[model samples]
Target: MSRELRLAEVFVELADTLVDDFDVLDLLHTLCERSVELLRADAAGLILADQHDVLQVMASTTEEARVLELFAVQNEEGPCLDCYSTGEQMANINLDEVQQRWPRFHIATAEFGYRSTHALPLRLRGQVIGVLNLFCAEHAVLSDADVKLGQALCDIATVGLLHERVVRQGEVLAEQLQGALNSRVLLEQAKGIQSERAGIGVDEAFTLMRAYARRTNQPLRTVAEAVIDGSIAADELKRPR
Candidate 1:
């Protein structure tokens, strides 16, 4: 198949993975494989940044590629870091011509036989999330068309990842809401138990529960769950230990 058709197929496949139970690892694995195939890169890898701004190797086309990418980060040099830091596309970086720019990165990747590298930032609007790295073993310089196509793929992937994150956050928000409701339910039940056992009002019961949890260094939720489940002796509540 032609490159355009292949890329279209990849987009379709990627879209199919966006269902409710999509596997994130599988999606990233496919992205790296498709980049290698459609971009004609010798190897490709994806680096994802966490909330802490720490970049981690998320997926790669080859183990050697993965090692080289990590070396790029550890050495604090190379196109990936440069692209990420600047939130710009970096391409056709010839290691031979610019060895001085990244001595350790050039040496480490050169040992693995990669002669050229490119990195594209995965960004949405002003927020740059990560980088897509492509390496060549044959000192290849990307043509204008190659650069455009590679950047397009990276942009698509960044949009997809960002959409997935928004969906995940929605799910997390729903879960948190459910958790809060569950906690409220358990607290009510615990209050009832304490009130009946201690001949106290619900407010007094809650205050006693909170005080005990704070004194014991246990979470209020844990104490409430225990009270509701009858694991905590009712007599234990009276003594405030």
Candidate 2:
């Protein structure tokens, strides 16, 4: 498919998340995956603030990206943190050039083979909930158009997350985001369990769990919880055909 057509499709998919039963974790993962495909990024990671205003790695396109995002959060430094705190987009940041500005993050990015990155805030009006991060394997710059497109995606994602229904429920924004973070923890545990049981990588385990969730018409979190609680066997999850 053409890039324009694919981009339009991505927008529609994100918009569909407005439904009452939409999964926040799945939506964030989709955002990361689509950002990598449409924005010339080698990998993508999403970091969202928890109820206590702490940044947590919510989704990533690759294992390396997830590790790097976790490193950023633990070290309390990186483009994502900066972007979230300032509520401004940090685009085309050359990791090598920012060594002095982000010493530990620079080393972490280098170790991950990422030479450049961009951080766009998931913001709506005055509230900034999280950041959408893009990583590049080469020292590169994003064109103005790409930066705009990335920010637009971030905006839409933020709106979807803080849906009007959630707002009308009063103080549910924090609760909703916290619930997604909690779901991520369950997913990680389930992935580890499935990986060990199936002798597969965590990524493959996640794929199987996601496939099972869709095939069974169940929420991904529910599937993950089932796996964690020993209600679902790893062998029960088949790869999607």
The most accurate candidate by TM-score is: 2
What value of lDDT does candidate 2 attain over all alpha carbons?
0.89
Worst 10 contiguous positions by lDDT, candidate 2: 232-241
173 in model 2: Cα distance from truth in Å?
0.7
**Candidate lDDT (C-alpha), each:** 0.73, 0.89
TM-score of each: 0.67, 0.95
Off by over 4 Å in 1: 164-241
Tens-digit lDDT string for candidate 2 (116-150): 99999999997999999999999878999999999
Error of 1 at 95 (Å): 1.1
Q: For model 1, what is the error of residue 151's alpha carbon versus the real structure, in angstroms, after optimal superposition?
A: 1.6
Clashing pairs in 2: none
lDDT of 2 at 30: 88
Worst 10 contiguous positions by lDDT, candidate 1: 172-181
